[model samples]
Target: MATAAIARPQVSDAEWEARQELAACYRVFAMLGWDEMIYNHITVKVPGEDNAFLINPYGLHFSEVCASNLVKIDIDGNKLTDNPYPVNPAGFTQHSVFHRHLPDAHCVMHTHTTAGMAVSALEGGLQPINFYACNFIGQVAYHDFEGVTVRAEEGERLIANLGDKRAMFLRNHGILVMGKTLPQAFLMHWGLQRACEIQMATLSMGQPVHVPEDVVAVHQRDLSKVQIPGGPGKADFDAMVRLVDRIDTSWRN
Candidate 1:
């Protein structure tokens, strides 16, 4: 865990809360092994600001991230706050598109987990092979890999491909999820990761049992019931937040 050497920024209470939540998400991602070295991103729009948002500083491991260390940036990825940490605008170009174009897209996350990349490389692309996968039937969208996503022009095409879906499969790349809040996005990625894991496991054992279309449709119809109780992904994310706190609470600094 990182020490609290970084000074907390002067900001609104809502923004502070956003920063804490975003920082906790980084620790949670690190705890879950969803981190990819110093790469990957989970961005959240700063409350009461149209273009301002929070993201992980470049070159910091997820485990080293904290509320005070998160970099605040604008729609164009320019730093909006004073900080010694470096910001990688090009790295988060893909995330900016979602944050700009999508409604309620307060949080956008991307990951390069092994199972996620495996499923992305598959020709079928996230088939409904299990319950977790079934919940996203006809809801997940795919965008062809257009190299490192540094090009701003690709955003239009990616948005067109994604339509209104919250989950996206970055073909030959990895997985992406967006949400109105961190908890919702966290749960979405958790389900996506589990879906990929189970799908890979089942495929290795030869022909798997097929889930009838009717069952899949029913599952989709009732996915709301399976959501985090009392709020969208609230209980699930809060529980994980608790677990991460137990491991190391330094993320809140």
Candidate 2:
């Protein structure tokens, strides 16, 4: 008989929170059918200084993620934590391009949901087709697809495409949105997802969809005022935590 050998990964408390949130984000997105298998990633800048980021380990389903599962890496893509989970270099390239330059970007959310991919395939990109689309109006950016995004050279192109916007539609790929806080990013993602859903449904109906310029302008103004009154935008965060609790509360475990 042959004996089996195994090695375990170690994660800390700080990394733990990052894992929980990342896992919850995954579970919620999976529940919504927004995951692109294990391809797309959601990364959160580690709290405080040190220039660290946390991401999913390569081979696991999002639903299987937990506080103990995330892998930490530095801006240079070096695995800094004591975890044996292999980091995806291409995934790091996709995420690090933003983290290195975008100081305001703390939580980066990327998804390959059906609606997002459907809209990405359209030559027009995300048009100002409706009010929800207006939330993305001038704020949306675009990145052209450059193969599988595995090359380090592609980082420059990704950065150029992202430019100065917090929301982007990666042509031939999917959607990416960044938030200063998790709730802000998550809310923006909700808008982006809803916009994609509307785009797909409307286009499938085989009818032209139109939004008056004046109406889009009005909603843009309304969206500008759409922040919670005080306290670190935790309301939406709490709400989402509750939603995660309803489905699978073990993310924190």
Highest-scoring model, TM-score: 1
Q: What's each prediction's TM-score?
A: 0.96, 0.89
What is the alpha-carbon lDDT of model 1 when measured against the actual structure?
A: 0.89
Clashing pairs in 2: none
Model 1 misses residue 81 by how many Å? Answer: 0.5
Q: Write the per-residue lDDT of candidate 2 for residues 1-253, one digit (tens) a residue.
A: 1211223245556656666777788777777777766678888998874488888777667776666667778988888867656777767888887888889889888888888888988988887886678878778988888777778788788778778888888888888999887777888888888988988888888876677778888888876476776444467667777787888876665
Separately for all candidates shown, the number of backbone clashes (residues 3 or more apart, or on different chains) is 0, 0
Candidate 1 residue-wise lDDT, 1-253, digit = tens:
2333678899999999999999999999999999998999999999999888899988899999999989998988888888777766555688888888886899999999999999999998988889899988788999999888888999999899988898999999999999988998998999999999999999999987878889999988887775545678889889899999999998888
Q: Where does the lowest 10-residue lDDT sum fall in candidate 1?
A: 1-10
Candidate 2 clashes: the total is 0
User: What's the residue-level lDDT of 71 in candidate 1?
Assistant: 90
For all candidates in order, the CA lDDT equals 0.89, 0.77
